[model samples]
Target chain A: MQGLAHQLIAGIATGGIYASVALALVMIYQSTHHLNFAQGEMATFSTYIALTLIQAGLPYWVAFLATLVISFGIGVFIERIMLRPMQNASVLANVGVFIGLLLVFRNAMGWIFDYTIKAFPTPFDTGTPLFGGLVSGHELGSTAVTLVVLGLVYVFFRFTKLGLGMRAAAFNASSSRLVGIRVGWMLALGWGLAAAIGAIAGIMIAPVVFLEPNMMLGILLYAFAGALLGGIDNPGGAVLGGFLVGIIENLGGAYLVGTELKLTLALGIIICVLLVRPTGLFGRVVQSRV
Target chain B: MDAGRDRIGTGIALPAAGAAERSAARPLRLLGLLGLVAVAAVLPPLFASSYQLFQLTLALIFAIAILGLNIVTGFNGQISLGHGAFYAVGAYATAIMMSHFDLPWWETLPVSALICAAFGFGIGFPALRLGGLYLALTTFSLAVAVPQILKYKGVEDWTGGVQGVFISKPDAPEGLGLDADQFLYLVVLAFAVAIFLLAHNLLHSRIGRAMRAIRDHSIAAEAMGMDIARIKTRTFALSAGITGLAGALSAIAIEFVAPDSFSVELSITLFVGLVVGGVGSIVGPLFGGVFAVFVPNLAESISRAAPGVIYGVILIFFLYLLPQGFAGFPQRIRALLRRRPEG
Candidate 1:
């Protein structure tokens, strides 16, 4: 029973990270209707930049804030420079470009930072026990960080005019344009926010997984499963799905399939969810018109 | 079919008809295609070195894989970023059959093809529900997870875990004067031509038209009484079968099978090949095959550490300059020349 509790706690901690990345994926999907395959790579690059700042003697919190801002800018820049031109192109071409972006970011990180795994510093200290030893200090702190980010995103979308404009643009670009909203800028903003969120996920995850060029590949897959399981369109569902996936992954790894097949477990969940519920648990069913 | 509806539906009636008329003066295009095949078959044996023959064989194998990808993705408009998983399945099937059962390499091809087709059929059921980005994600997940699955402890008996399994190269018949590499190259070439011809025939058939109709408008195709689900599932199977054949050929040519060989990078390479070669054209996969076989080596030669970066840059450059791909170059040039004369 204690072991199971420990597994759940660990799963929730990891799931928080997955939720953040899943939310980022959902954000990009919301606007472009195209999944950014490079989202994971982009987050890794953002984390590298944060590491550079920390290595330059800046405080951890300062580096974190700087990384978020820089990641947002990079996302917007990518949208303006690479994606905007291909807006009217075929879906295959668009997807091809996204793959290209993934390669670029992944290889660029290896080129700049090298493929050596580096230890990332956690803001949370390891001295204290949390939740009667069920959760580590870092896990607790990371989950708290993830929730705070999620809450802030919720507030922004619910209360801010820019967020509302972005939502309107994503919901109906033509109608949003008719209403004088800058639809293109809204998309860029969406990409930026998504990048920022992905950066946080990466930053939080790196300490646990250790930082490397390919650190986020497995996490990204889990997040993909989560996003799909929760309904890729529903942000709240995605978050819930992320935690659920995390719990399942942990419990399955512990009791079911073992650790070697954990990635396959994620894949299996994705296939099962897709087969059973295409609209996802939270997504509205869309009808194809003749 | 109504000519007007064909025009509206296909958007290629006039150009295709004109091309057919042009073909009438040059005998049949089929004859020309066969002649090209004959040249491909005969020339390498006469002039190419062993190393060159090996490269050509690898390129042909890639062509088969890309053609398979083109079936479901290019023709049916289903994006599969996980064809490499099918390819891996095919390779492993061949490897295990040959290594474990001591089965003849020739016999494993059909078995591999059947296994991969089954996989595709199973995947297609889920794919019926997931569309567009969701499907791509699921497939991408498959690609990422496949290597790990292959390395799992339960499968280690057959898979050999990380070390992988290697097979002996098949030798030429005693009557033939050719060596193993040359024989393998010829074998791959024969398979390539046969598969290419098969794809060509399939794409030009009535079923091909239905597949394209579904791709262009699934709802409309369904309204017209086409069973969209059956067609798509079958297309997936066919595509996987062909790709599996390519993987079988690759295993023979390389004489090895490993989890590392069938990475997500392989899937990406095939996809890049499809896009760069042109999506829908019959010969596009041939171009894609050449790109897949040669580009990474070229990138590595330029910079070993950052070959992926180079590949990415070149990919973006091509996407920017030639959105329609290398297969569209001839058409683009013709359009340019026509415009120049008019101007």
Candidate 2:
């Protein structure tokens, strides 16, 4: 029982990170209908920036906030410069560009930061165990940070006028244009927000995974499984799905396939969800007229 | 058949060659082809070292792999970021057959092709339901997971685990009066020629028309009574089989198979080749293969990070500026020349 509880706590902590990244994915898919294949790489770049900032002695929270802003600007810049021209292009073109960005970001990070893995500093104290050793201090603190970010995002979308305008633009670009919303800017904002959220996820998970160019690849896969599971289009459902996938990954890794096959387990979940319930647990069936 | 041709004309119509012009060019075209073949056959042995021959053989192998990718992504409109998975499967199948079963290397190709085709068919079934982005996502995950799966303990005996499997390289026949490197080069060239011809024939056939029809517009094709699911699944199988054959060839050429060699990077490299060579063009894979094999070495010579940087920049630039790739360059030039005279 104790072991199961420990696993569950650990899973939730990791799942919280996945949930954040999944939300970021959903945000982009909601607007552009294009999966940002470079999302993971972008987040990794942001985390590296955070590491650089801290190393230069900018306090933790200050560095974190600055990284988020810089990441947002980078996201918007990429959309405006690279993706905007390909808006009317084929699926292959869009995918090809995303892949290009992925390679550029991954290799650029390797070049700049070097491939050696570095230990990331966590804001939370690592010396203490919380809740009778069920969870570590970093796990608890990171989960709290993730939840706060998720809540802020939910509130922004639910309450803010800018968020409402972004939603309207995504839901119907033509209609939103008639109603005087800048549809193009909304898409860029969506990219920025997604990038920022991804930054949070990257930073939160960095303590556990360590900081490296390839750190987010497996987590990205897990996040994909989560987003797909909750429905690619549903933000709330994706978050729930992300947490569920985290729990499943932890338990499955522990009891079923062992640690070596955890990635395979994530792949299986993605395929199964896509095959059995592609719209996901909470997704609406989208219809198109020929 | 005429109607199908007309439909394809509406899709990506090449400038129609008049019968008289075609006849006039036929012998010249054949002579050119023969000249090219003769050069391919003799140039490596006469002017190049054994190492150069090996590199040329690897380039031919990559061309085969890129051609397979083009069949699905370029012609059939299915984005497979995981063709490396098929390539890996093909390699393993060949390795296991040669090392475990003590089978001759030539015999392993067909078995590798069959296994990869079946694997492709299986993956294709689910693909029938998934659209572009979803399929890309699924395949990407498959690519990411493949290395891990190869290292799993369950299949370690057959796979040889992380250390990987190796087989002895085949030598030339005694009567051929050729060394091992030259023989392997010729053997690979022969296979490359045969496969390229087969692909050319396949893409120009009725089934090829059907595949293109589906790619251009699935709904219209379905209305025309085409079995969308079956054609797609079979196309996937065919594509996978071709790539797997390339993998088998690569295994023989390199004399080894390791999980690390078939990383997602290989799939991306093949994709880069397809884009650079020109998608949906019969001759493009040759250019793509050369780019795939040679460009990285060129980039690496500059710096450690140069390859990925070069590949990324070139990929984006080509997508934006030369979407038709190198294979389409001649037609593009012709169009430009004709337009300049008119303007």
Candidate 3:
């Protein structure tokens, strides 16, 4: 029973991070219909920047804020420079470009920061029993922040004019353009927001685990599973899908299998789900244009 | 009267009439392809240095694997990120069969391919519709999960886990005066050429046209009377089968097959090669295979500051600057050199 609760708690915490990342992935998929293969790598690079700043004796909050702004700018720049130019290209070419970006960011990080694992300090209280020492409050704090981020995204997409414009652009770019909405800016905005979200995810995740050039590879997989499981189009679906995956993975690892086979089992489940429910758990069934 | 040569000239219009004309005009296309094969056939003797020959050998084997990727992602328009798992499956099966059952090399090759094809068929049953990110995730998970599952405790006898198992030397005939490097390259070359030609034919065949159609627009293709699901699933299996053959040969060449050798990194390399070498073209995989083999080697030699970083950077640059890939370089270069080139 104790193990079950522990696994549940851990799953939710990790799942929060996955959901947060999945939220960004969902946003990008909605706006561009192209998956940003470099999302994790971008997050990783920004997180490293934050780590470098914090290590230089800057206050944690200041560094965090600075990192957010810089990440936003970087995202916008990437959109303008890389994606925008390839926007009207063929699907394969666009995908190839992003895959290229993934390589660039990953390699840049490896070259600049070094590939060896390094510890990044967390803003939340560390080495202290914040939650009466029963469980690590760090994870709890992470979940709280993820929830807050999710809420902000919800509010942004639901109520704001910019959000409305972005949504319109996402649904149909040509129609959005006809309505005088700047579909181009909306895409840039979406990319920028996604980048910021990924940055926050990276900073939050780094302290919980060791930081390396490929640190996000595993999480990216989990988030990919989450986005696909939840229905790639819906933000809320991504969150739900993420938690579901986390819980299943943790519980499976604890009770049915050892840690080694946990991910493999999760993969099996995803494949099975795909076979049975191609539209995913939350995705709307899309009819082919037959 | 029926037994006569019967002036059988009473034929209907051939669907592939244009194909014959295209092939005749592009005689150099076949020549260029043969030129490549001749390069491989002569490599062992020309490059007596084992190191360089081994690299060529590895590249040719990987060409087979990359060719598999091209069929799915390049031709069929499905992105698979877990092919390394299939490669590993073939490798482990070969290693185990040769060491334990003492299976002959000839026997293990087909067995390895069948096992991998089975895995691919199994994965493709559900994953064909995932598309883009979902497909990427499913395959990525398979790639990551395979190694971990194999690394688990109970599989030690078959897998050797961290220690890894090595295979027996290949049974090369005595008359073939080729050294191990030369011998292995020749063996791999034979299958690689056969597979390449098979894929070439399949790509241009009726089934190939159906796959490309399905990839471009499944709905329209289905409306056009193509079975989308069947084509997609079969394409995945066919692709995996070729990759399995590569894995089997690679197992022999290196004489060692382990989980580490078949990491997601190798799969990424395969993808990078496909994209940069030009995906849909028959020659693209060959170009990609060579790039995958040579670029990293060149990078490591030029600088040791994280060779993969260099490879990744170059891959991204190529994706951005040259999406048509190296195979399209002649046209691109000609276009650049002159304002236009006559077709």
Per-residue lDDT tens digits for candidate 2, residues B1-343, read 1223434546654445644565687799778878998899998877889988899999999999999999988888888888999999999999999999999989999999999999998877786666557768888888899999999999999999999998988989899899988988999899998988888778888898888888888889889999988998899899999999999989998999999998888888988899999877778999999999999999998778879988999999999999989987877888799999888
Q: B1-343, model 3: which lDDT tens digit per residue?
A: 1101111112334447655765576777678879988976895657658787778888888889999988998888888877888888888888899998998888999999998888898888777755555666677678867777778788889999977889866755889776777777787888989998898788778888788777777778889887787788888988898898888888888898777777777777888888778867777888888898888877777555455666666665776677768876876876677875533
lDDT of 2 by residue, A1-290 (tens): 99999999899999999999999989989888888888999999999999999999999999999999999999999999999999999989999999899889999998899999999999998887778888999999999999999999999999999999999998999999999999999999999999999999999999999999999999999999999999999999999999999999999998899999998988899889977998999999999887
**Candidate order by decreasing lDDT:** 2, 1, 3
How do all the candidates rank in terms of TM-score, highest first?
2, 1, 3
Give the DockQ of candidate 3.
Answer: 0.62
| Over 4 Å off, model 3 | A127-133, A288-290, B1-39, B130-133, B302-306, B333-343
Q: Per-residue CA lDDT of candidate 1, range A1-290, in tens?
A: 98999999999999999999999999989888888899999999999999999999999999999999999999999999999999998777788888999889998898889889999999897788877888898999999999999999999999999989999999999999999999999999999999999999999999999999889999999999999889988889999899999999999999999999999999999888877887779988866543
> lDDT of candidate 1 vs native?
0.88
User: Could you give the fnat of all candidates in order?
Assistant: 0.70, 0.68, 0.68
Ten contiguous residues minimizing lDDT sum, candidate 1 chain B? B1-10
- Of candidates 2 and 1, the better by DockQ: 2
Candidate 1: residue pairs that collide = none
Q: What is the DockQ of candidate 1?
A: 0.75
Could you give the CAPRI-style class of model 3?
medium
